[model samples]
Target: MNTTKLAGNFLLPISLLIFSLTAFSCSADLEDKVVGNWQGYDFLFQKTEGPDIVVTINGGLEQHLRSKLILSDNGTFQKLVGEYDNGKGTWVVEEDKLITTNENGEKLIYTLLKVTDKELMTLHEVDLKTPDGTLKGKIILSYTR
Candidate 1:
């Protein structure tokens, strides 16, 4: 067997293993940063055809109605966005996205803008249907520990 060919074959697997390990480490780092209790304080709703609304929940009764998200190390989460959107389910971080699957098998994907020991910011676009028409907008949920 040619020595160069033998060395090349071994190098490929080793390189791939190193790459996989590095990626897993980075993913675990993100998972660690997000595993905590977070309180939603800023809810920004930007609509495509209407006025954008911003709701800032201060330290009062408003805080009681704001979003609360709990991300666990066991790959589960509970999310309550405002007074309506509430569910408990499993969650995973894929690249820059935080994906959650609720008990009803509904998937909510949030694009993660930032995540730190104290803050997690995410944006999710939604289409709401009403008797008038379909309203398209994006919701930015900002949470703090």
Candidate 2:
């Protein structure tokens, strides 16, 4: 094969690889956009029960605790919920998930629903034991800067 033809064939693949890497790197930048203080405005917990496990929403005035999450540019974070303070620790973003580990080596993960300069929303699922059986629920958190 001629040298020019051989080089042309390699160029397309190289260009595609570069483009793919650029796109992947941009996705990772989403973490940087989330580095700031976020004040929790709404925290809704939906609990399910009975044979069908129907979900019921309990929030608004029922939630008395104030909460906040502060994320530093250095990959460290602190979470404050009411009077309880979850010790600071390291945090990272993997795809659409935010994974955080506390000072006590406890790990918590939240699914990123939406994040912007002004607002952030996340969802977390929890299983709790009830008198009847195991109940599945979700805690949805809405925050603002």
Candidate 3:
């Protein structure tokens, strides 16, 4: 093939390769921003039953003393270690949401609202049902990194 034809044939592939590389790099940078140690606190509400009656209740707040978030390069796997007033537990991030299951099989879900070099914010919601009825609450958590 002539020089001009050969160059034209290779130009498209080269341009596509460069574009793909740029996109991958940008995504990787974003993922890096999400990976690190993050600490926060959560206020929770729960329903309780007394000898007399079942009641909707506000569970006292708990502080998250420390948390470490690790994200894999491909963003497929994430692990979280969170320390709270009661104890510490392992968590996982799925679909950009953080969830942890306690020994009692209670599942807690948290959505990451914002993360910065010095701060992190999350929203938590829990719903439960008992013989009496269903109860739910929304709580906001904030932390300093």
Candidate 4:
């Protein structure tokens, strides 16, 4: 067995192990691109319940509360509406989805549409139970950094 050939064979596995460890630390939880401060841009509410008619419902309960949305690298988030505040929650990116769990234990799953260094837009499907009945719809929140 040639000594140089044996040494070279051991080097390949060692080099791959080092590369894999570095890659793992760099992408821990996959939240790198979304950890930043975002400003509220615009929002749209759509009701997707009816058979033929699609109506835009208005009012508030996750309304267009506009201001600052801060997504920390530590996996926590805060949304400020005006000065009083809107809500605070923990957020994580699961594949292409942004999952947020509010303080009230309400979990809202949002489909990550477009996330960039400048803008972040998400679509959230929600079911609200009121005195009348259940309202099924989706909300799109657009934000810019």
Candidate 5:
């Protein structure tokens, strides 16, 4: 076997391994940016050709119902929607999606649309009951610390 060819073959695998490790470390660091207290900044549930669902921020009932999410580096989370709707869950990031599995084995998947040091926006789709019928719509949630 040619010596150069042998060295080239070994170098490719070593370079790939190093790249994979670096990517994984960077992903962990990105996840760390999500660890902290996050308050609801925007919540829009819009239906096709219709007005958006309202989330009042002026200390009304809907404002009081807004949830605060706390993410921990240990992959655990607490979401307090209201006095009666506190939830605990485990979360993981797969690619750009955030998957949260609650204690009851229900999983909610959110596509991470944006993430910054102070803001995180996620898109979720779900079947919702409308006046006409049931249909799938998007829920855009924005959070800030």
Candidate 6:
């Protein structure tokens, strides 16, 4: 092969390898940013037979419930506190969504609304089925780190 042709072939593969490595590194860094101690305000509303009840959810519930969430770099852990509820259990992040399971192993789906250096917001809804059909309660949680 001519000098120019050989150089072009070598450069092409090297450039592609470098690009792939950089992309993977960046993705790993972003995943780390999601892991840490985050504090924020949470409001939970539930629809009951009598009326709608609004409760302010914090780190500890009613001075009786205490929880902690430790999100690791691998997206797996034991008993991470739920942001909306006092339930404690494991959590996992798949794609753009975060799935939290309480001690009972019930899955809670939360979609990432907004995530910044100081704030993280998520929206979730509980599936409720009644004689009339299906009803769901919506919840929004805002947190600051």
* Candidate 6 residue 132 C-alpha distance from true site, Å: 15
Tell me the whole-model lDDT of each prediction, alpha carbons only. 0.67, 0.66, 0.45, 0.65, 0.64, 0.49
Cα deviation at 118, candidate 3, in Å, is: 2.0
- Pick out the ten consecutive residues of candidate 4 with the lowest summed lDDT: 50-59
Give the per-residue lDDT of model 4 (tens digit) for 1-145. Answer: 4332343455446434533443342223446877899887766555545321223243432345457888998889987876767789898887666888989988878766556678777767767766556766666677898
Q: Residue by residue across 5-123, what tens digits does model 2's lDDT show? A: 34335544643453344334343776987899988886645443323332322333134237778999899998776757757899998886788899888888886766778877676
TM-score of each: 0.68, 0.65, 0.42, 0.66, 0.66, 0.50
Best by lDDT: 1
lDDT of 5: 0.64
Estimate the lDDT of model 4: 0.65
Better of 1 and 4 by lDDT: 1
Give the per-residue lDDT digits (tens) of candidate 3, residues 1-145: 2332343355446434533443333423434555555554543332222221222332223223343434333433223434323433445655535565655566777665554566555566646564655555444455564
Segments in model 3 whose C-alpha atoms lie over 4 Å from true places: 1-85, 128-135
Model 5: per-residue lDDT, tens digit, 1-145? 3432343355445434533543443446658777888888775443433323332212223552377888898999898875445788899887766888999989999866666789877667667555655645555677888
Among all windows of ten consecutive residues in candidate 2, which has the lowest summed lDDT? 52-61
Lowest summed-lDDT stretch of 10 residues in model 3? 46-55
Off by over 4 Å in 4: 1-30, 50-56, 60-65
Q: Candidate 4, clashing residue pairs?
A: none
